[model samples]
Target: MTDLKVRKLPWEFDESVPFQWNRENPRFGIMMNAVSFLAPAFERFIVSSTRAAMAQITDPATLEEADAFLRQEAIHGRAHRNHTAALVKQYPGLKQVLVDLDASYDRVLKTEPLEYHLAYIADIEATFTPLFSVMLNHQDKLFDIGDHRVGPLFLWHFVEEIEHRSSAKIVYDAVVPSPWYRLRVIPKVVAHVMGCFSMFCRAVDTHVPAADRGIDACDMIVRPKRLTSLFERSELPGQFEGVPRTEVITMLYRLARAQAPNHSPATEKVPAFASEWFEAYEQGKDVVNWYRPARVAG
Candidate 1:
């Protein structure tokens, strides 16, 4: 059995919340906003795919973990739904973007086999520990300066992802038991995720006003021509100037390692902030307003 806590966080977003929530890095903010667009649909896919695969997961402990994992993912879906609803209220055109994302995942669910879907989820979830570790490690730079509502939402999500780091792999191993197949499907999964992000960025570009968004929604995406130019110049663009070169290189290396068949997320080093957040939550501190004091002296 996995020791995962299904904490229901009270997250509320008001009209005052801005699209450029992270004032220090607008590009990062927009990129993460794209993730917010993707989360609900993607989590829905995860829940459905995992539920379908549960029949093959005969191990009682693994089955219990799967149930807990589904509960956490369901809660995450609800939180992200509230977040995206606020965004849609701000920019009604974003409604179409949500529709498009749902349709894309619906197509995948209808077309892909259960094995492929399980492998896809396993591959993606395997990367989160390392990926979110980097983000949480640098939270002072990336998240602490952002809107409290948005930053804490991502913090809660990422820490819980680390909490159940072994879940998808455990389920996949029980059902499919083919690391080669999981590795073989990585490219397709990466392409689909990037395509969804591309769709989100393009939608934001077309819909969210420039002043509100504060940067080109597509700035972080690696297009063909942009890749060629970067390779030729070996120089970072202005948008990426805020991020240290070493951190980027380290993140890439960790992500690559995460894809290995022998790679185990349990062995990976988690960020200190994750532990701190968990401690704070258990202590009944105000986790939703993470960066701000909950009360001021009179």
Candidate 2:
């Protein structure tokens, strides 16, 4: 788990910071907040699923990694809960959207088999691993565009997400160990993630007034290049687009393959800055000093 550190972050959100914090891009900001709204619950799911599997594993190294993963997730969930609490209070209607997400997660937790839960963890973590890379690679641009205070929370979260990317797969393979089982479960997991993402976007758009709304990217699903840029750059005032359902599914296919018995994800390198940040933390140095973009030679 790369020595996962449970750093106490200063995460405080309020109406003073616009709802669309990312360069005032309404939909982008909403999408980011929507993810935050669902994060605490989703992280709790990860913790429970991983811990349940950890109970059955016998390897000491796996057990240690599992413990560290749980601690990091526990802190992550707390930070997100605090932020989301602030969000729902500002926009009361968002409570309903979060309720819907909670209901969906509850239904799965109560009905699905243990393997399904493990598969879901592996599925989402796989997606996050590469997604984190994209964010880290473009952090300077993203942070510059977004609210500075909120930026560190995301920076901290995604860095740790990359650090523990393999924990779920490690636990999943230990327990399930069947390629056939993964193939069946992976699609279902992809469907769930994408479905929830769509629901969150719609919910945010519905409750947030048009005057406050940024460009809606929902209509641009077919444009892959634009969608790719969404992750790499902040959207300007007039440019709004999103990832297509088919493309998300295709990306999930590749992510799932990386979780296969003998394969590795092509984009597995953790960003150099993120590595340096955590390494500094381990040595009791001020990691905030390393969060800035590396200076380029002119």
Candidate 3:
């Protein structure tokens, strides 16, 4: 992990895993594209969170670690943007959509204050840590998207979510000198989640199907054979290297307990995500089964 120095945003990543946007597979590409718009917004929040709380971060070691955290997020954002561009070549309309989304982030920055922004980051990533676990454990959760490419990208993002679950809070606690931050950030983040969901829903309505562009993360969890249906159609067996959904959620709870103070995920007012995670675990799925590590793949 120490050697995993953070990389900057907008970096190049080759995402040529053979994706197509047909009627049945309508949302895979769109979901990929939709998540793509979040990159710039995500990046700006990280950068601002880091700087906004700079004065509070006293430990040199912690600051250095936070710097690496920022670096990785930057890399993620850049890679996604470039990936979006490559996909744009396939779907020309997305280019304008992507630009508008980036512009929207700028608009958000101007509207919200620093505390509100950091709280939103905490809330979003907090929601992300769990929802991501379901996707990260695609097989166990039984989310059979029936594709090889998107899952890997999503897994990579999920792992990174775990990697930096504590960053925003760390920065906020260090820099922002307000007890209200602890209380305020939660509701503030909840509101942000509402707005963010609306944005995704809007994007989905404009682009893909209801199921494909889900309104809540809970809807995505599958109950065995559900996810595999897609891949079966693609000639790949439904079985894949996914971790246990319960284990994944448990790991997140552990991480949450470690990351969030006072120990209540609900007070954290989590975005509408836990049900999706619980269902994935109810399905007793694990994505590690679908995962082919780079070492083995190579």
Candidate 4:
């Protein structure tokens, strides 16, 4: 059996942390903050979508995993909402965008067919699960780019994502077990998520001042690059400590292709650091400070 459980991590978002939390990489900070901006609403949707499907699942183990998944997502939403509340005070534009997103989710929950919601949740988990593994595997490298609190919050989130990677797939299979249906939904999910990310990035660029833009963190992925001389240099955000730009591009491509009939969450390999982090958790160490510069050796 897969080792899956909802972990109650003690991470408090420092309200005093600046909007340009990634001191070394402002673009990364913007992209991360954009993710934070979206998380509360996105996660709430996930929890609700999962709960809506719960009445159909009868397997005791699957039902237990689904419950844990819902608990984890709820906590995740609360944490991101708290952090985003602090962020909106610095960048008020983000709050409006979040409100709009919340309304959009509400509309979907109220009107969309149940299968569509389950497909979105399942495909998104499959796509993000591997990317979260990359983040964990490369955690040490990312430690230097952000404020002490910032990187760990993301790492903590990614760790739980890894822990419950199979829960959504289990629910998806239970509720909407049609490959053809899933295949149609995967493309829509990828396009929707990428579109949302692009919108968030542009919103940041529009609202934040120039000196703090950092690395145009995610624009390179969304827009085509113009050829430039070596001396001209690229403004793209640097790769997360250990993962390369190529790996990210590859992951995005795989996400786009994840609807293939052969793909299954059961076969996705868990990252080494995820296991290491859980062992530390089991040992009762403070995970919130897992990526502190003092704790990590260069």
TM-scores of the models, in the given order?
A: 0.93, 0.80, 0.62, 0.86
Candidate number that wins on lDDT, 1 or 4 = 1
Pitting candidate 1 against candidate 2, the one with the higher lDDT is: 1
* TM-score, cand. 2: 0.80
Residue by residue across 1-298, what tens digits does model 2's lDDT show?
A: 2355566765666666556677544444665676687787788787888788888899888888788887888788888777776767777787787778877887888899889898788767777775665556656545546765566677778888888877777777788867457657776886777667777777767776655556553542324356454344343532233344454454446555666655543247667867766877678764332334432221
Candidate 2 segments whose C-alpha is farther than 4 A from its true place? 24-27, 217-257, 264-267, 280-298
Worst 10 residues of 1 by lDDT: 230-239
lDDT of 4 by residue, 1-298 (tens): 4356677766666558777787665545676787787787778999898888988888887788888888999888888887877777777876777787787677778887778888888777777776776666666655445777777778778778877877887888888868678778666666767666766676767766656655553453454353222113345544453466667766666665655645776667778987887798899777777656465775
Local accuracy of candidate 1 as per-residue lDDT tens digits, 1-298: 6798888888878667887798677866886787788989999998999898897778899999998998899899888888888888889899998889999999999998988998888889988887788788878777877887798899999999999888888888888867889999988998999899999988899989988988777766777668543223223223343456677678778888877888887888888999999999999998888867842421
The true-versus-predicted C-alpha distance at residue 135 of model 4, in Å, is 2.2
Q: Which stretches of candidate 4 lie over 4 Å from their true place?
A: 215-233, 239-257, 292-298
- What local lDDT score does residue 253 receive in model 4, on the 0 to 100 scale? 64
lDDT at 218, model 4: 46
What order do candidates take by lDDT, descending? Answer: 1, 4, 2, 3
Q: Quantify all predictions' global Cα lDDT against the true fold.
A: 0.83, 0.67, 0.52, 0.72
RMSD of each: 2.6, 5.3, 9.8, 3.6
Q: State the lDDT of candidate 3 residue by residue for 117-168, as single tens digits.
A: 6666655666666555444445333334444444444545556666566666
Which residue pairs in candidate 2 have backbone atoms (N, alpha carbon, C) closer than 3 angstroms, thus clashing? 26-214
Give model 1 RMSD, 1 decimal.
2.6
Question: What local lDDT does model 2 show for residue 139?
Answer: 62
